[model samples]
Target: MYRYLDSRPAGNSSISLLARAIGKIAQTEGDHTTAIPALTLHRRNAPTKPLHCIYGLGLGVVVQGEKQVMLGDAVIDYGPGQSMVTTIDLPVVTHVARASFHEPFLGLVLTLDSRHVVQMASEMELPQPSRGGVYRPISIEALDGPLVEALARLVGLLDEPALLPRLAPLIQQEITIRLLAGPHGSQLQHLVASGSPSQQIAKAVAWLKQNFTRTLHVDELAARAHMSPSTFRQHFRNITGISPLQFQKQLRLQEARQLMLNQDLDAGNAGGQVGYQSASQFNREYSRLFGTPPQRDVRRMRAN
Candidate 1:
């Protein structure tokens, strides 16, 4: 069984308390989804290899241990008393940088609702995010006292499931309000503000995610976002840390891997399912992204 270090120094009390609450429910090494919608508890007893996935809009708080997220050429590392907010769906390579059997990594993620953010920002009448400044969809901020306390209270609600359905939303709202009023607020504001470059690029990203298997036409996508192709390309890369075509390819490759691993589909069929018309091209791209041939990678993952 995992035990929280109650004897830890008072300076770390808030994080330690959150870790204790997480340790109680997440006794094993994996993601635990709670009855509280869009909330997930994560536990890892040891360090892990790089795992690539799409991180949707959410707030991730690390109560214990450390991790890193790689986006294109950017690398972000965060640990205890730190939180990360991703304002858009982004493909990232993430791994635990620090963890141990005795002191496992513990964390939680709460999905953010864009519509709710827009509603709150409007009511608050916060100043518009500065224009033309490149704001990556993800950012890190040290957790302040009030925000940390609110997060701890949110986890505490699990002990009283009867009150969760009613209280969870209120707590989640508080968390959102804090985020909007905090350092990362500018990025969230950029996401919802009308006609902002981030907002326009976000719309294009949504369409690409939904139609990853379809052929991509940069001009058409740019027009959809109401920008010239050149401007759209620049802003897309600025916000997502990759070109639009690269983003779609990553989405395709990720879905293909999932299909192969979960449904036991063959490489060629999986490739076709994810918009790859040529088996050779798919093999080359798959090997490039995953560091191994499709079959070999699948076998290796299963063995692990």
Candidate 2:
């Protein structure tokens, strides 16, 4: 179990209020998506197996309990009063690390609009982010009083359905402004600033995701991002914590798994659908990543 210590006096009240609100709504052990299209609340009563998925641009806040997320070799653990911001889409493994019947894991994720971020950055006249340093796509930091208050108010709006249409956008904007002005300012700026390394890599990532089923040529991808193959490879690995080939493999395997589970496709068909030409090689890599052969893994997932 994780013990939470709130050192900020002003934030304690808001955090408590937010926790209560989340607990009331997330009464069961599952994910709850509210009327706010971009917001989702999560609840878990016990530790869970690590699940793989793609995390897009969003803000995640843990009002109670603890969770862990793994990006390639990087592992991040965060608890109450801590928030994580992901500026680019990345494949990650995540699980609830600590929770119990008495104190279930409670958290919320708010999808961020990159276009709005660009508009706000322009209006704020924030300087361009530094280009020389390493900037990971994801960051974790302690939530400040203003951000927590804004989030609490956003959740509080759920009580008034009529007011949500009128007020949610304003609070969401406030949350975005706070994030841009907080410790994550530079990272967010890097994501939006034109021709920045992070932005360039983001473009390459977007291309890879859209064309994952096709053959990938490193030089072609690099050229599309206006980077040399070597520089693009380095920046991609630095930001996403995985080489291009590894990233592509993850995408293929994840998609194959979904096809097998949802479409009732056989292992061979799913593998071929995801760009694998050799059945033996596909089964080998599928077992390596998912810890089971395709059919068996699908069965287990369906059973759960």
Candidate 3:
């Protein structure tokens, strides 16, 4: 899509072919985690519905098909030649746009460790920001040969069963280094470094995640991140594009949905487990965020 991705042409090994290979691996092994424990590959057929936000750091590469991930007001798309990189955990609505019986969507997800990202940044002669950089929740760009080749080798290891246990983790680390040197690595560096807003807010985010069920106090969280309440509030909004309360609310609801869908809990009970005092309030918030009530959403997901 973007000028043949630097003369390599993706060759005749089209993304569709890659998708088929990944799909077959999934079929035989049951999940990508089994074949390559270091990376998580989601091989699925395309459809219109969106998936709930998953809070994790990763590089999302599309080997076949297309997808768009929505973060706040921004929508970022990735397909055959592109990928999505998330340096910090944020809520997002993602949808697949292309697929069929003839072609399924193949994608690989690599978990990012912020410490390693910062370490890579420190090793490089990175520029110091003269001013605040661009404000965007997601950034996209073309995938080049280095990224493609690393991914290919990582994927190929699935078939070379005997080599996986020893090799998978190493490749995954290489992929992380590759991304650190790639286009968007600078922003990722800022995210995990001490004193950066991204780092401060991420610290607050981790706290919320670990203590999601507890009642939140803005002042306490701000103190925990070593910032004044006002400064923490402003930075939290800037980095995540959402207020602290809103972030916690999404976390609570998303966790509730997972419980209902995976643990077979009823809607009201799930809400209660996540610090919701009233089921009616939970249903109202769930409907607003998901555009459907909990029971209906879970039922439709199950039928699918």
Best by TM-score: 1
Lowest-sum lDDT 10-residue window in model 1: 1-10
Q: Going through the candidates in order, what is the number of backbone clashes in each? A: 0, 0, 0
- Candidate ranking under lDDT, highest first, comes to 1, 2, 3
Please state the error at residue 93 of candidate 1 in Å.
Answer: 0.8
Tens digits of per-residue lDDT, candidate 3, 167-260, equal 8778777877777677766666667556767677878888888888899999999988888999999988877768889988999999999999
lDDT of each: 0.89, 0.88, 0.74
How does model 2 score by TM-score? Answer: 0.93
- Rank candidates by TM-score, best first: 1, 2, 3
lDDT of 1 at 77: 83
Candidate 2 per-residue lDDT over residues 73-152, each given as its tens digit = 77888888888899998999999999999988999999999889889988996766766755768888888888888888
Q: CA lDDT of 263 in candidate 3?
A: 99
Once fitted onto the true fold, the runs of candidate 1 whose alpha carbons sit more than 4 angstroms away are 1-11
Residue 3 in model 2: lDDT = 26
Runs in model 2 deviating more than 4 A are 1-10
Better of 1 and 2 by TM-score: 1
